[model samples]
Target chain A: MKIFLHRRGFIARIAALMVLPFVAQRRAFAQSEAVDSLIEKITGGAPLQRGRVKLEIPTLADNGNSVSLRVVVDSPMTPSNHVKSIHLIAPKNPRPGVASFFYGAGAGRPQISTRIRLSGSQGVIAVAVSACWDAS
Target chain B: MAARISVPQNARRGDSIEIRVAIQHPMETGYRTDDNGTSIPKNVINKLACRYNGVEVFRAEMGSGISANPYLSFFIIAANSGELRFDWVDDAGVTGSERTSIIVAG
Candidate 1:
């Protein structure tokens, strides 16, 4: 009876060990999906081109409560071809949307710097929308 | 609520000048418990707008994710000699503003 009980307990432990990774993976997948939907809502399903917007944040922040962030978008900042807005998002924060900056005709270079709070370690995403889409 | 705005006193017309603002606020995230174990309600600046001589030039919408004592910096083209006015409001309906003049040469 003792050997049988020990065998059952070992099997149970093995099962739990096998399920742990999948559980973690499912959680990670859900989080990325949520971020994707949020981005889609902002861009209206527009294709996100990856080369123009630059997001700078600390790779290993000592403090998660407040971290400095900077975003620079490549734009001429002309009257007709300027960045209309920039959105900062933190996927793992209590509130995902960090901030949104809007620029008018008087805006010059498309760049901003600010401080943000992070609940935990996560990737920060910066989205810059231009007033007019550039083919080049 | 005290706020500070930094802008160069003089800039040539068509020059891209940087503007910075730092304000004092708790930016309570609604996730913190006080000494008595009462949850602190969220109160952060919701909207901030900047106008150049009565023309809106920049605006921002911030959330609780912003750290306390929010600081922001951006660039704006110096068109003419005028006042750069900043107006912001918080979640508790408190409004604050600060203005500074800049002289544009040439």
Candidate 2:
């Protein structure tokens, strides 16, 4: 009886060990999917490039609640060349669409600075669309 | 209550005008746990719009990513004396606005 009980205990421990990792992995995958869906909704199938928009964020955020951020687009603030909109996205935040800024020729600068909350360390993306440049 | 906007009392025409605004908010994310281990409801500013001289120049859609007491800075072309208005809304459907006038000079 003792041997039988020991065997059952070992088996149960092993089963738990196996199940825990799978559960954790599943949660992680779900989070990733959520973030992807948010990005898709914000961009509306627009291609996202790496270097067009400058996203200035701290390499390591001390607080997951509020982080300072600045987004600057490399566009002239002219009537024909100014940036139409700027989208700031945080993939892992509870609300992924952090902010969207719209600017016109009347806006003297194509830059925005504000404080943002981050759930954790994650990739921050900034998408800027201009009147002349095609969506990418 | 309405949000508060602070800008220079006088701005010169042809010079860049700096505008700053701060709103009182908690900007809570639903993921946070309270002292009793209960999840807090999400509350954040979802949108902010700024208009100068009756024309819309800048607008932003905010989210939980924005911190409490949100502060935003931007600039506008100083052309003529007019009013600068700021409007913001949160996820809970709460709205606030503030406005100030500037003296533009050539």
Candidate 3:
């Protein structure tokens, strides 16, 4: 009985050791689907590339009340190729949503500069989606 | 709600112009305590948008992290001469909008 119990304990320890890092990695990825789904609401669940979206914010912020933020997306402003919208998400804030920007063909470029509030230190996410539309 | 807006009154057609919008609000985060030690309710502009020539140009979904009296700057091509409209809404459902005219030099 003692040997069987000891083996069971050993097996459980090995199992925990194997799974801990993956759990740790998930925690480290800043995975906040809660805010991502908000973007999904606007995109209608279309596929999106995690590229072409740029966000500029201070690496270190002194105040949780307000922080300067800038976001940009690469796109041609032609009626056939244009950015549909841009959004900012702050996962740790009391309100995770920071901002959203919708761009038309007339928006020569997809970029914006603004100040936002942050309740604490967290990863900020920027996402942009584009679609073609007729000028008429 | 009154807002201050800036845009190039005159721009060559096809030229890109910058639009600036500044709105007035307290953007209360509801985290701070008043003189009576009661927690203030969170109130901030949750959404913002800019429309050019009656078409949507840019829109933003904001949170309490947004500063009081938010200021936003963005770009738009001078496609046709028309007015640019900026509008926003707070948590309390109060809405505000402002308009500025732009002359596209043909």
- Chain A TM-score of prediction number 2: 0.65
- Highest lDDT among the candidates is held by which one? 1
- The fnat scores of all predictions, in order, read 0.82, 0.77, 0.81
> Chain B TM-score in candidate 1, rounded to 2 decimals?
0.98
Q: In angstroms, give how far residue B87 of model 1 lies from its true place.
A: 0.3
Looking at model 1 chain A, which ten-residue stretch has the lowest summed lDDT?
A10-19
Per-residue alpha-carbon lDDT of candidate 1 for residues A18-136, written as tens digits (9 for 90 to 100):
01111222222233677778666666555555557777776766666667878888888776577888888787676888898999888878899999887666667787777654443
Q: What is the TM-score of each candidate against the true structure?
A: 0.85, 0.76, 0.77
Q: Kindly report the TM-score of the first chain in candidate 1.
A: 0.72
Better of 1 and 2 by lDDT: 1
DockQ agreement of candidate 1 with the native complex: 0.43
| CA lDDT scores, all candidates in order | 0.77, 0.67, 0.69
Candidates sorted on TM-score, descending? 1, 3, 2
Write down the TM-score for model 2.
0.76
Tens-digit per-residue lDDT, B4-98, candidate 3: 88999999998888888888899877777778888778788888888888998777777665788988999988889889888889999999988
Candidate 3 chain A lDDT trough over 10 residues, lowest sum? A10-19
Identify the superior model by lDDT, candidate 1 or candidate 3.
1
- DockQ order, best first, reads 1, 2, 3
